[model samples]
Target: MPNPAHATGTDLLVLHALRCVGFAGLARVSEAVGLPEPDVESELIDLAVAGLVTRVPGDFGGWGLTEAGRAADAERIRDELDTAGVRTAVTRAYEDFLVLNPELLDLCTAWQMRSVDGVIAPNDHTDPGYDSRVLERFADFHRRADAVCAELSAALLRFQRYRDRLADALARARSGALDYVVDDMGSYHTVWFQLHEDLLATLGIPRH
Candidate 1:
Protein backbone atom coordinates (compact mmCIF):
# COMPACT_ATOMS: atom_id res chain seq x y z
CA MET A 1 0.00 0.00 0.00
CA PRO A 2 1.07 3.54 -0.71
CA ASN A 3 2.10 5.53 2.35
CA PRO A 4 -0.33 8.22 3.43
CA ALA A 5 2.61 10.13 4.90
CA HIS A 6 3.44 11.65 1.51
CA ALA A 7 0.68 14.21 1.98
CA THR A 8 2.31 15.37 5.18
CA GLY A 9 5.42 17.55 4.82
CA THR A 10 8.63 15.57 5.26
CA ASP A 11 10.40 18.52 6.89
CA LEU A 12 7.97 18.63 9.77
CA LEU A 13 8.09 14.85 10.05
CA VAL A 14 11.88 14.82 10.44
CA LEU A 15 11.88 17.80 12.77
CA HIS A 16 9.17 16.45 15.04
CA ALA A 17 10.66 12.97 15.00
CA LEU A 18 13.85 14.49 16.34
CA ARG A 19 11.77 16.15 19.04
CA CYS A 20 10.25 12.80 20.06
CA VAL A 21 13.29 10.51 19.78
CA GLY A 22 16.07 12.89 20.86
CA PHE A 23 19.72 12.34 19.87
CA ALA A 24 19.18 9.66 17.25
CA GLY A 25 21.23 8.88 14.15
CA LEU A 26 19.90 8.99 10.59
CA ALA A 27 18.81 5.34 10.72
CA ARG A 28 16.98 5.76 14.01
CA VAL A 29 15.23 8.88 12.77
CA SER A 30 14.14 7.09 9.64
CA GLU A 31 12.68 4.25 11.73
CA ALA A 32 10.81 6.69 13.94
CA VAL A 33 9.10 8.31 10.96
CA GLY A 34 8.83 5.17 8.77
CA LEU A 35 10.50 7.06 5.94
CA PRO A 36 13.38 6.08 3.71
CA GLU A 37 16.87 7.02 4.95
CA PRO A 38 17.62 9.16 1.90
CA ASP A 39 14.45 11.17 2.35
CA VAL A 40 14.91 11.50 6.11
CA GLU A 41 18.60 12.40 5.81
CA SER A 42 17.77 15.05 3.21
CA GLU A 43 15.33 16.68 5.60
CA LEU A 44 17.82 16.44 8.47
CA ILE A 45 20.39 18.29 6.40
CA ASP A 46 17.85 20.97 5.62
CA LEU A 47 17.01 21.27 9.31
CA ALA A 48 20.72 21.52 10.13
CA VAL A 49 21.14 24.30 7.60
CA ALA A 50 18.31 26.20 9.30
CA GLY A 51 20.07 25.80 12.69
CA LEU A 52 17.26 23.75 14.20
CA VAL A 53 19.33 20.62 14.87
CA THR A 54 22.96 19.58 15.20
CA ARG A 55 25.00 16.42 14.72
CA VAL A 56 27.31 14.96 17.30
CA PRO A 57 30.34 12.70 16.69
CA GLY A 58 31.29 9.75 18.87
CA ASP A 59 30.47 6.09 19.46
CA PHE A 60 27.21 7.36 21.01
CA GLY A 61 26.80 10.21 18.51
CA GLY A 62 23.57 11.04 16.75
CA TRP A 63 21.33 13.96 15.73
CA GLY A 64 19.73 16.14 18.37
CA LEU A 65 17.66 19.30 18.36
CA THR A 66 19.31 22.58 19.17
CA GLU A 67 17.82 24.94 21.74
CA ALA A 68 16.25 26.86 18.91
CA GLY A 69 14.81 23.66 17.51
CA ARG A 70 13.23 22.67 20.81
CA ALA A 71 11.67 26.09 21.19
CA ALA A 72 10.35 26.01 17.64
CA ASP A 73 8.92 22.53 18.10
CA ALA A 74 7.21 23.55 21.33
CA GLU A 75 5.52 26.46 19.64
CA ARG A 76 4.56 24.45 16.55
CA ILE A 77 3.20 21.54 18.56
CA ARG A 78 1.12 23.85 20.73
CA ASP A 79 -0.30 25.53 17.68
CA GLU A 80 -1.06 22.19 16.08
CA LEU A 81 -2.93 20.97 19.13
CA ASP A 82 -4.91 24.17 19.52
CA THR A 83 -5.68 24.37 15.83
CA ALA A 84 -7.06 20.86 15.83
CA GLY A 85 -8.83 21.49 19.15
CA VAL A 86 -7.87 18.01 20.31
CA ARG A 87 -6.07 18.79 23.52
CA THR A 88 -8.77 17.07 25.56
CA ALA A 89 -8.85 14.07 23.27
CA VAL A 90 -5.12 13.58 23.30
CA THR A 91 -4.91 14.12 27.02
CA ARG A 92 -7.50 11.46 27.71
CA ALA A 93 -5.70 9.00 25.49
CA TYR A 94 -2.51 9.72 27.40
CA GLU A 95 -4.26 8.75 30.60
CA ASP A 96 -5.18 5.44 29.05
CA PHE A 97 -1.64 4.95 27.85
CA LEU A 98 -0.31 5.42 31.36
CA VAL A 99 -2.54 2.68 32.64
CA LEU A 100 -1.31 0.33 29.94
CA ASN A 101 2.32 1.32 30.42
CA PRO A 102 3.00 -0.57 33.64
CA GLU A 103 1.24 -3.64 32.33
CA LEU A 104 3.43 -3.65 29.26
CA LEU A 105 6.56 -3.37 31.36
CA ASP A 106 5.49 -6.30 33.49
CA LEU A 107 4.64 -8.35 30.43
CA CYS A 108 8.03 -7.64 28.92
CA THR A 109 9.75 -8.66 32.14
CA ALA A 110 7.84 -11.89 32.16
CA TRP A 111 8.94 -12.53 28.64
CA GLN A 112 12.59 -11.91 29.45
CA MET A 113 12.97 -13.57 32.83
CA ARG A 114 11.24 -16.23 34.85
CA SER A 115 11.23 -17.16 38.51
CA VAL A 116 12.18 -20.64 39.55
CA ASP A 117 12.86 -21.83 43.11
CA GLY A 118 12.85 -18.26 44.36
CA VAL A 119 15.42 -17.28 41.77
CA ILE A 120 14.85 -14.79 38.97
CA ALA A 121 16.84 -15.96 35.98
CA PRO A 122 16.82 -15.33 32.26
CA ASN A 123 14.15 -17.28 30.41
CA ASP A 124 15.89 -19.88 28.31
CA HIS A 125 12.69 -20.48 26.33
CA THR A 126 12.80 -24.13 27.28
CA ASP A 127 9.22 -23.84 28.48
CA PRO A 128 6.97 -23.49 25.50
CA GLY A 129 3.84 -23.25 27.63
CA TYR A 130 5.20 -20.29 29.58
CA ASP A 131 6.22 -18.48 26.45
CA SER A 132 2.87 -19.09 24.83
CA ARG A 133 1.07 -17.61 27.81
CA VAL A 134 3.14 -14.44 27.64
CA LEU A 135 2.50 -14.05 23.93
CA GLU A 136 -1.24 -14.41 24.43
CA ARG A 137 -1.21 -11.66 27.02
CA PHE A 138 0.78 -9.49 24.66
CA ALA A 139 -1.77 -9.99 21.92
CA ASP A 140 -4.57 -9.02 24.26
CA PHE A 141 -2.68 -5.92 25.41
CA HIS A 142 -2.04 -4.86 21.84
CA ARG A 143 -5.78 -4.89 21.18
CA ARG A 144 -6.44 -2.41 23.97
CA ALA A 145 -3.49 -0.28 22.93
CA ASP A 146 -4.77 -0.11 19.37
CA ALA A 147 -7.97 1.50 20.58
CA VAL A 148 -6.03 4.32 22.18
CA CYS A 149 -4.00 4.73 19.00
CA ALA A 150 -7.16 5.09 16.95
CA GLU A 151 -8.43 7.90 19.16
CA LEU A 152 -5.13 9.78 18.97
CA SER A 153 -4.74 9.28 15.24
CA ALA A 154 -8.14 10.85 14.66
CA ALA A 155 -6.89 13.87 16.58
CA LEU A 156 -3.48 14.15 14.88
CA LEU A 157 -2.36 12.65 11.60
CA ARG A 158 1.24 12.27 12.76
CA PHE A 159 0.06 9.79 15.37
CA GLN A 160 -0.80 7.30 12.66
CA ARG A 161 2.86 6.46 12.35
CA TYR A 162 3.04 5.22 15.94
CA ARG A 163 0.10 2.90 15.35
CA ASP A 164 1.85 1.55 12.29
CA ARG A 165 5.14 1.06 14.08
CA LEU A 166 3.56 -0.56 17.10
CA ALA A 167 1.69 -2.97 14.88
CA ASP A 168 4.91 -3.91 13.14
CA ALA A 169 6.59 -4.59 16.49
CA LEU A 170 3.79 -6.84 17.65
CA ALA A 171 3.63 -8.60 14.29
CA ARG A 172 7.31 -9.41 14.38
CA ALA A 173 7.03 -10.64 17.93
CA ARG A 174 4.24 -13.01 17.00
CA SER A 175 6.33 -14.42 14.18
CA GLY A 176 8.83 -15.88 16.69
CA ALA A 177 11.16 -12.85 16.86
CA LEU A 178 10.52 -12.24 20.54
CA ASP A 179 12.96 -9.37 20.70
CA TYR A 180 10.43 -7.23 18.89
CA VAL A 181 8.47 -7.09 22.14
CA VAL A 182 11.07 -5.26 24.20
CA ASP A 183 14.61 -5.75 22.92
CA ASP A 184 14.75 -4.81 19.22
CA MET A 185 15.10 -1.40 17.64
CA GLY A 186 11.44 -1.28 16.73
CA SER A 187 10.41 -3.09 19.87
CA TYR A 188 6.96 -2.50 21.25
CA HIS A 189 8.43 -0.78 24.27
CA THR A 190 10.58 1.52 22.15
CA VAL A 191 7.61 2.70 20.13
CA TRP A 192 5.64 3.15 23.32
CA PHE A 193 8.32 5.42 24.79
CA GLN A 194 8.42 7.57 21.67
CA LEU A 195 4.64 7.76 21.62
CA HIS A 196 4.63 8.81 25.25
CA GLU A 197 7.20 11.50 24.48
CA ASP A 198 5.17 12.74 21.54
CA LEU A 199 2.09 13.05 23.73
CA LEU A 200 3.90 15.05 26.38
CA ALA A 201 5.49 17.33 23.79
CA THR A 202 2.22 17.96 22.03
CA LEU A 203 0.48 18.86 25.29
CA GLY A 204 3.31 21.06 26.52
CA ILE A 205 3.51 18.85 29.57
CA PRO A 206 6.79 18.31 31.37
CA ARG A 207 8.01 14.82 32.11
CA HIS A 208 7.62 13.94 35.74
Candidate 2:
Protein backbone atom coordinates (compact mmCIF):
# COMPACT_ATOMS: atom_id res chain seq x y z
CA MET A 1 0.00 0.00 0.00
CA PRO A 2 1.10 3.51 -0.68
CA ASN A 3 1.93 5.87 2.15
CA PRO A 4 -0.96 7.90 3.51
CA ALA A 5 1.23 11.00 3.56
CA HIS A 6 1.89 10.88 -0.13
CA ALA A 7 4.32 13.47 -1.43
CA THR A 8 2.92 13.66 -4.93
CA GLY A 9 5.21 16.60 -5.60
CA THR A 10 4.11 19.60 -7.64
CA ASP A 11 3.18 17.29 -10.48
CA LEU A 12 -0.25 16.29 -9.14
CA LEU A 13 -0.40 19.04 -6.54
CA VAL A 14 -0.24 21.89 -9.06
CA LEU A 15 -2.48 20.13 -11.53
CA HIS A 16 -5.09 19.17 -8.95
CA ALA A 17 -4.92 22.61 -7.36
CA LEU A 18 -5.93 24.09 -10.70
CA ARG A 19 -8.57 21.40 -11.03
CA CYS A 20 -10.18 22.45 -7.77
CA VAL A 21 -9.47 26.23 -7.64
CA GLY A 22 -10.21 26.79 -11.32
CA PHE A 23 -8.22 29.33 -13.28
CA ALA A 24 -5.71 31.13 -11.07
CA GLY A 25 -2.45 33.04 -11.31
CA LEU A 26 0.88 31.81 -10.02
CA ALA A 27 0.37 33.40 -6.61
CA ARG A 28 -3.06 31.86 -6.03
CA VAL A 29 -1.82 28.51 -7.26
CA SER A 30 1.14 28.69 -4.91
CA GLU A 31 -1.14 29.60 -2.03
CA ALA A 32 -3.44 26.72 -2.84
CA VAL A 33 -0.61 24.17 -2.90
CA GLY A 34 1.36 25.73 -0.03
CA LEU A 35 4.38 26.01 -2.31
CA PRO A 36 6.58 28.79 -3.65
CA GLU A 37 5.62 30.61 -6.85
CA PRO A 38 8.81 29.63 -8.67
CA ASP A 39 8.16 25.95 -7.99
CA VAL A 40 4.52 26.19 -9.01
CA GLU A 41 5.44 28.15 -12.14
CA SER A 42 7.94 25.51 -13.15
CA GLU A 43 5.33 22.80 -12.66
CA LEU A 44 2.80 24.83 -14.61
CA ILE A 45 5.28 25.15 -17.45
CA ASP A 46 5.86 21.43 -17.52
CA LEU A 47 2.11 20.74 -17.36
CA ALA A 48 1.60 23.15 -20.25
CA VAL A 49 4.27 21.35 -22.21
CA ALA A 50 2.40 18.11 -21.54
CA GLY A 51 -0.82 19.77 -22.80
CA LEU A 52 -2.42 19.33 -19.41
CA VAL A 53 -2.72 23.04 -18.64
CA THR A 54 -2.42 26.40 -20.36
CA ARG A 55 -1.69 29.94 -19.31
CA VAL A 56 -4.01 32.61 -20.59
CA PRO A 57 -2.86 36.17 -21.26
CA GLY A 58 -4.36 39.64 -20.72
CA ASP A 59 -6.21 41.02 -17.72
CA PHE A 60 -7.91 38.41 -15.50
CA GLY A 61 -5.71 35.80 -17.15
CA GLY A 62 -4.33 32.84 -15.27
CA TRP A 63 -3.41 29.18 -15.54
CA GLY A 64 -6.28 26.80 -16.15
CA LEU A 65 -6.52 23.07 -16.67
CA THR A 66 -7.16 21.68 -20.09
CA GLU A 67 -9.74 18.97 -20.61
CA ALA A 68 -6.86 16.55 -20.52
CA GLY A 69 -5.72 17.98 -17.23
CA ARG A 70 -9.16 17.57 -15.73
CA ALA A 71 -9.34 13.97 -16.89
CA ALA A 72 -5.86 13.27 -15.65
CA ASP A 73 -6.53 14.78 -12.25
CA ALA A 74 -9.66 12.72 -11.77
CA GLU A 75 -7.91 9.52 -12.72
CA ARG A 76 -4.83 10.12 -10.64
CA ILE A 77 -6.69 11.29 -7.57
CA ARG A 78 -8.95 8.25 -7.62
CA ASP A 79 -5.97 5.99 -8.03
CA GLU A 80 -4.18 7.68 -5.17
CA LEU A 81 -7.12 7.31 -2.83
CA ASP A 82 -7.59 3.66 -3.69
CA THR A 83 -3.88 2.85 -3.63
CA ALA A 84 -3.46 4.43 -0.24
CA GLY A 85 -6.48 2.40 0.96
CA VAL A 86 -8.02 5.53 2.35
CA ARG A 87 -11.11 5.98 0.21
CA THR A 88 -13.46 4.88 2.97
CA ALA A 89 -11.61 7.06 5.44
CA VAL A 90 -11.77 10.07 3.15
CA THR A 91 -15.39 9.38 2.33
CA ARG A 92 -16.25 9.37 6.02
CA ALA A 93 -14.39 12.64 6.46
CA TYR A 94 -16.28 14.15 3.56
CA GLU A 95 -19.54 13.11 5.14
CA ASP A 96 -18.50 14.76 8.38
CA PHE A 97 -17.60 17.87 6.44
CA LEU A 98 -21.07 17.95 4.90
CA VAL A 99 -22.56 17.97 8.38
CA LEU A 100 -20.49 21.02 9.29
CA ASN A 101 -21.02 22.77 5.97
CA PRO A 102 -24.32 24.42 6.80
CA GLU A 103 -23.13 25.80 10.11
CA LEU A 104 -20.16 27.37 8.34
CA LEU A 105 -22.42 28.96 5.73
CA ASP A 106 -24.54 30.39 8.52
CA LEU A 107 -21.43 31.77 10.22
CA CYS A 108 -20.29 33.48 7.05
CA THR A 109 -23.70 35.01 6.62
CA ALA A 110 -23.66 36.26 10.21
CA TRP A 111 -20.24 37.81 9.66
CA GLN A 112 -21.39 39.56 6.49
CA MET A 113 -24.82 40.69 7.62
CA ARG A 114 -26.57 41.58 10.82
CA SER A 115 -30.02 42.53 12.02
CA VAL A 116 -30.30 46.23 12.74
CA ASP A 117 -33.48 47.96 13.83
CA GLY A 118 -35.44 44.84 12.75
CA VAL A 119 -33.96 45.10 9.26
CA ILE A 120 -31.13 43.05 7.84
CA ALA A 121 -28.14 45.18 7.01
CA PRO A 122 -24.58 44.54 5.93
CA ASN A 123 -22.19 44.26 8.85
CA ASP A 124 -20.11 47.36 9.14
CA HIS A 125 -17.92 46.04 11.97
CA THR A 126 -18.72 49.25 13.88
CA ASP A 127 -20.37 47.35 16.72
CA PRO A 128 -17.69 45.84 18.88
CA GLY A 129 -20.09 43.73 20.91
CA TYR A 130 -21.69 42.13 17.87
CA ASP A 131 -18.31 41.44 16.29
CA SER A 132 -17.05 39.88 19.47
CA ARG A 133 -20.06 37.57 19.68
CA VAL A 134 -19.51 36.45 16.11
CA LEU A 135 -15.84 35.86 16.75
CA GLU A 136 -16.71 33.80 19.76
CA ARG A 137 -19.01 31.61 17.68
CA PHE A 138 -16.24 31.30 15.10
CA ALA A 139 -13.83 30.14 17.72
CA ASP A 140 -16.36 27.57 18.85
CA PHE A 141 -16.90 26.44 15.28
CA HIS A 142 -13.18 26.15 14.65
CA ARG A 143 -12.80 23.64 17.42
CA ARG A 144 -15.22 21.28 15.71
CA ALA A 145 -13.76 22.01 12.28
CA ASP A 146 -10.28 21.22 13.51
CA ALA A 147 -11.41 17.74 14.47
CA VAL A 148 -12.73 17.05 10.98
CA CYS A 149 -9.55 18.42 9.44
CA ALA A 150 -7.44 16.20 11.63
CA GLU A 151 -9.32 13.18 10.38
CA LEU A 152 -8.87 14.26 6.76
CA SER A 153 -5.17 14.98 7.08
CA ALA A 154 -4.65 11.58 8.65
CA ALA A 155 -6.08 9.99 5.52
CA LEU A 156 -4.30 12.30 3.08
CA LEU A 157 -1.55 14.71 3.96
CA ARG A 158 -2.38 17.28 1.28
CA PHE A 159 -5.59 18.01 3.15
CA GLN A 160 -3.44 19.32 6.00
CA ARG A 161 -3.01 22.63 4.17
CA TYR A 162 -6.69 23.39 4.55
CA ARG A 163 -6.44 22.75 8.26
CA ASP A 164 -3.44 25.09 8.50
CA ARG A 165 -4.98 27.81 6.34
CA LEU A 166 -8.28 27.69 8.15
CA ALA A 167 -6.58 27.94 11.52
CA ASP A 168 -4.45 30.85 10.32
CA ALA A 169 -7.48 32.74 9.11
CA LEU A 170 -9.33 32.24 12.36
CA ALA A 171 -6.26 33.21 14.38
CA ARG A 172 -5.92 36.43 12.41
CA ALA A 173 -9.58 37.26 12.82
CA ARG A 174 -9.38 36.64 16.53
CA SER A 175 -6.44 39.03 16.56
CA GLY A 176 -8.65 41.80 15.09
CA ALA A 177 -7.90 41.37 11.43
CA LEU A 178 -11.55 41.52 10.40
CA ASP A 179 -10.78 40.92 6.74
CA TYR A 180 -9.36 37.52 7.54
CA VAL A 181 -12.84 36.33 8.44
CA VAL A 182 -14.36 36.70 5.00
CA ASP A 183 -12.99 39.56 2.92
CA ASP A 184 -9.41 38.65 2.00
CA MET A 185 -8.42 36.17 -0.66
CA GLY A 186 -7.04 33.84 2.01
CA SER A 187 -10.00 34.43 4.27
CA TYR A 188 -11.63 31.68 6.30
CA HIS A 189 -14.65 31.49 4.03
CA THR A 190 -12.44 31.47 0.93
CA VAL A 191 -10.36 28.56 2.21
CA TRP A 192 -13.49 26.72 3.27
CA PHE A 193 -14.98 27.12 -0.18
CA GLN A 194 -11.79 25.84 -1.76
CA LEU A 195 -11.79 22.87 0.57
CA HIS A 196 -15.34 22.17 -0.49
CA GLU A 197 -14.23 22.26 -4.10
CA ASP A 198 -11.26 20.06 -3.36
CA LEU A 199 -13.40 17.46 -1.66
CA LEU A 200 -15.84 17.38 -4.55
CA ALA A 201 -13.05 17.13 -7.09
CA THR A 202 -11.33 14.34 -5.23
CA LEU A 203 -14.51 12.33 -4.86
CA GLY A 204 -15.39 12.87 -8.52
CA ILE A 205 -18.66 14.35 -7.44
CA PRO A 206 -20.30 16.93 -9.65
CA ARG A 207 -21.04 20.28 -8.07
CA HIS A 208 -24.68 21.15 -7.85
Candidate 3:
Protein backbone atom coordinates (compact mmCIF):
# COMPACT_ATOMS: atom_id res chain seq x y z
CA MET A 1 0.00 0.00 0.00
CA PRO A 2 2.15 2.76 -1.25
CA ASN A 3 0.73 6.26 -1.41
CA PRO A 4 -0.31 6.71 -5.02
CA ALA A 5 -0.59 10.46 -4.56
CA HIS A 6 3.11 10.76 -4.00
CA ALA A 7 4.89 11.69 -7.20
CA THR A 8 5.82 8.48 -9.06
CA GLY A 9 8.33 9.83 -11.57
CA THR A 10 11.08 12.42 -11.57
CA ASP A 11 9.43 14.35 -14.37
CA LEU A 12 6.18 14.72 -12.50
CA LEU A 13 7.96 15.74 -9.38
CA VAL A 14 10.00 18.29 -11.30
CA LEU A 15 6.91 19.66 -12.96
CA HIS A 16 4.99 19.84 -9.71
CA ALA A 17 7.91 21.45 -7.95
CA LEU A 18 7.92 24.22 -10.49
CA ARG A 19 4.18 24.50 -10.24
CA CYS A 20 4.46 25.27 -6.54
CA VAL A 21 7.80 27.02 -6.29
CA GLY A 22 6.73 29.32 -9.11
CA PHE A 23 9.93 30.00 -11.12
CA ALA A 24 13.28 28.69 -9.92
CA GLY A 25 16.73 27.80 -11.16
CA LEU A 26 17.89 24.25 -11.84
CA ALA A 27 20.01 24.27 -8.73
CA ARG A 28 17.04 25.19 -6.56
CA VAL A 29 14.84 22.54 -8.13
CA SER A 30 17.58 19.94 -7.78
CA GLU A 31 18.03 20.76 -4.13
CA ALA A 32 14.30 20.73 -3.46
CA VAL A 33 13.82 17.27 -4.96
CA GLY A 34 17.07 15.83 -3.56
CA LEU A 35 18.07 15.04 -7.13
CA PRO A 36 21.28 15.77 -8.96
CA GLU A 37 21.40 18.91 -11.08
CA PRO A 38 21.83 16.94 -14.29
CA ASP A 39 18.95 14.64 -13.42
CA VAL A 40 16.67 17.53 -12.64
CA GLU A 41 17.62 19.25 -15.87
CA SER A 42 16.81 16.09 -17.83
CA GLU A 43 13.42 15.77 -16.17
CA LEU A 44 12.68 19.44 -16.78
CA ILE A 45 13.47 18.95 -20.44
CA ASP A 46 11.06 16.05 -20.73
CA LEU A 47 8.36 18.00 -18.95
CA ALA A 48 8.97 20.93 -21.23
CA VAL A 49 8.64 18.64 -24.24
CA ALA A 50 5.28 17.45 -23.00
CA GLY A 51 4.15 21.09 -22.74
CA LEU A 52 3.56 20.69 -19.05
CA VAL A 53 6.33 23.13 -18.16
CA THR A 54 8.63 25.67 -19.75
CA ARG A 55 12.12 26.97 -19.19
CA VAL A 56 12.83 30.65 -19.32
CA PRO A 57 16.30 31.73 -20.27
CA GLY A 58 17.79 34.88 -18.73
CA ASP A 59 19.40 36.19 -15.59
CA PHE A 60 16.03 36.35 -13.81
CA GLY A 61 14.58 33.21 -15.29
CA GLY A 62 14.54 29.47 -14.84
CA TRP A 63 11.62 27.03 -15.14
CA GLY A 64 7.86 27.18 -14.52
CA LEU A 65 4.80 25.09 -15.05
CA THR A 66 2.54 25.87 -17.97
CA GLU A 67 -1.19 26.46 -17.60
CA ALA A 68 -1.85 23.00 -18.87
CA GLY A 69 0.54 21.60 -16.34
CA ARG A 70 -1.18 23.40 -13.52
CA ALA A 71 -4.58 22.15 -14.61
CA ALA A 72 -3.33 18.61 -15.00
CA ASP A 73 -1.62 18.64 -11.63
CA ALA A 74 -4.77 19.92 -9.96
CA GLU A 75 -6.88 17.20 -11.52
CA ARG A 76 -4.40 14.43 -10.88
CA ILE A 77 -3.46 15.43 -7.37
CA ARG A 78 -7.07 16.04 -6.41
CA ASP A 79 -8.04 12.63 -7.71
CA GLU A 80 -5.21 11.08 -5.73
CA LEU A 81 -6.31 12.76 -2.50
CA ASP A 82 -9.93 11.87 -3.05
CA THR A 83 -8.99 8.30 -3.78
CA ALA A 84 -6.97 8.15 -0.58
CA GLY A 85 -9.84 9.74 1.35
CA VAL A 86 -7.57 11.78 3.57
CA ARG A 87 -8.89 15.20 2.71
CA THR A 88 -10.40 16.08 6.10
CA ALA A 89 -7.36 14.86 7.98
CA VAL A 90 -4.97 16.63 5.64
CA THR A 91 -7.04 19.80 5.75
CA ARG A 92 -6.94 19.87 9.52
CA ALA A 93 -3.18 19.41 9.42
CA TYR A 94 -2.88 22.21 6.89
CA GLU A 95 -4.71 24.51 9.26
CA ASP A 96 -2.15 23.69 11.91
CA PHE A 97 0.70 24.30 9.48
CA LEU A 98 -0.80 27.68 8.70
CA VAL A 99 -0.69 28.61 12.36
CA LEU A 100 3.04 27.92 12.37
CA ASN A 101 3.79 29.53 9.01
CA PRO A 102 4.08 33.12 10.16
CA GLU A 103 6.31 32.20 13.06
CA LEU A 104 8.56 30.22 10.76
CA LEU A 105 8.89 33.12 8.35
CA ASP A 106 9.66 35.42 11.25
CA LEU A 107 12.43 33.09 12.32
CA CYS A 108 13.84 32.94 8.81
CA THR A 109 13.84 36.71 8.57
CA ALA A 110 15.58 36.98 11.91
CA TRP A 111 18.17 34.49 10.79
CA GLN A 112 18.93 36.31 7.55
CA MET A 113 18.63 39.86 8.82
CA ARG A 114 18.55 41.37 12.27
CA SER A 115 17.51 44.61 13.88
CA VAL A 116 20.29 47.17 13.99
CA ASP A 117 19.84 50.77 15.16
CA GLY A 118 16.07 50.31 14.74
CA VAL A 119 16.59 49.26 11.14
CA ILE A 120 16.86 45.73 9.77
CA ALA A 121 20.29 44.85 8.49
CA PRO A 122 21.78 41.71 7.04
CA ASN A 123 23.35 39.55 9.74
CA ASP A 124 27.03 39.61 8.89
CA HIS A 125 27.71 36.63 11.16
CA THR A 126 30.42 38.64 12.93
CA ASP A 127 28.72 38.56 16.34
CA PRO A 128 28.82 35.20 17.98
CA GLY A 129 26.37 36.18 20.73
CA TYR A 130 23.68 37.31 18.29
CA ASP A 131 24.20 34.23 16.22
CA SER A 132 23.91 32.03 19.27
CA ARG A 133 20.64 33.67 20.26
CA VAL A 134 19.25 33.10 16.78
CA LEU A 135 20.32 29.48 16.88
CA GLU A 136 18.58 29.02 20.21
CA ARG A 137 15.37 30.44 18.79
CA PHE A 138 15.72 28.22 15.74
CA ALA A 139 16.07 25.18 17.96
CA ASP A 140 12.90 26.17 19.78
CA PHE A 141 11.09 26.81 16.51
CA HIS A 142 12.08 23.41 15.17
CA ARG A 143 10.58 21.73 18.19
CA ARG A 144 7.23 23.27 17.28
CA ALA A 145 7.70 22.60 13.58
CA ASP A 146 8.32 18.94 14.37
CA ALA A 147 4.80 18.65 15.68
CA VAL A 148 3.36 20.05 12.45
CA CYS A 149 5.48 17.73 10.35
CA ALA A 150 4.39 14.80 12.40
CA GLU A 151 0.77 15.66 11.84
CA LEU A 152 1.38 16.07 8.10
CA SER A 153 3.25 12.77 7.83
CA ALA A 154 0.45 11.02 9.65
CA ALA A 155 -1.90 12.33 7.00
CA LEU A 156 0.48 11.69 4.08
CA LEU A 157 3.72 9.80 4.30
CA ARG A 158 5.30 11.81 1.50
CA PHE A 159 5.58 14.72 3.92
CA GLN A 160 8.02 12.99 6.26
CA ARG A 161 10.92 13.96 4.01
CA TYR A 162 10.32 17.62 4.84
CA ARG A 163 10.73 17.06 8.57
CA ASP A 164 14.05 15.33 7.99
CA ARG A 165 15.31 17.96 5.58
CA LEU A 166 14.37 20.88 7.81
CA ALA A 167 16.09 19.32 10.80
CA ASP A 168 19.24 18.68 8.77
CA ALA A 169 19.31 22.27 7.58
CA LEU A 170 18.92 23.61 11.12
CA ALA A 171 21.68 21.33 12.37
CA ARG A 172 24.04 22.55 9.69
CA ALA A 173 23.20 26.13 10.53
CA ARG A 174 23.87 25.52 14.21
CA SER A 175 27.27 24.02 13.36
CA GLY A 176 28.40 27.34 11.80
CA ALA A 177 27.34 26.70 8.24
CA LEU A 178 25.25 29.84 8.53
CA ASP A 179 23.88 29.63 5.00
CA TYR A 180 21.86 26.59 6.02
CA VAL A 181 19.46 28.87 7.86
CA VAL A 182 17.96 30.59 4.85
CA ASP A 183 20.05 31.57 1.84
CA ASP A 184 21.59 28.27 0.78
CA MET A 185 20.10 25.66 -1.51
CA GLY A 186 19.23 23.27 1.31
CA SER A 187 18.42 25.88 3.91
CA TYR A 188 15.51 25.65 6.31
CA HIS A 189 13.64 28.18 4.18
CA THR A 190 14.08 26.01 1.11
CA VAL A 191 12.80 22.94 2.90
CA TRP A 192 9.92 24.89 4.36
CA PHE A 193 8.99 26.12 0.93
CA GLN A 194 8.86 22.55 -0.30
CA LEU A 195 6.70 21.58 2.64
CA HIS A 196 4.35 24.43 1.83
CA GLU A 197 4.13 23.18 -1.72
CA ASP A 198 3.52 19.63 -0.60
CA LEU A 199 0.63 20.69 1.61
CA LEU A 200 -1.03 22.69 -1.16
CA ALA A 201 -0.55 19.86 -3.62
CA THR A 202 -1.84 17.28 -1.22
CA LEU A 203 -4.93 19.38 -0.50
CA GLY A 204 -5.31 20.45 -4.14
CA ILE A 205 -5.20 24.08 -3.10
CA PRO A 206 -3.92 26.82 -5.38
CA ARG A 207 -1.05 29.09 -4.43
CA HIS A 208 -3.21 32.15 -4.91
Best by TM-score: 2
lDDT of 2 by residue, 89-138 (tens): 88899999999999999999999999888999999988999999999999
| Model 1 lDDT per residue over 90-116, tens place | 899999988999998899899989999
Tens digit of lDDT per residue, candidate 3, span 77-188? 6776676677887898889889989998988888778898899888888899988998899899899889988876765555666788899999999998988988886889
The superposed Cα distance between candidate 3 and the true structure at residue 155, in angstroms, equals 3.1
CA lDDT, every prediction? 0.88, 0.91, 0.80
Residue-pair clashes per prediction, in order, are 0, 0, 0
**Local error of candidate 1 at residue 96 (angstroms):** 1.3
The alpha-carbon lDDT assigned to residue 15 of candidate 1 equals: 91
Can you tell me which runs of candidate 2 are displaced by over 4 Å? 1-4
Q: Which regions of candidate 1 deviate over 4 angstroms?
A: 1-8, 58-60
Candidate no. 2 TM-score: 0.95
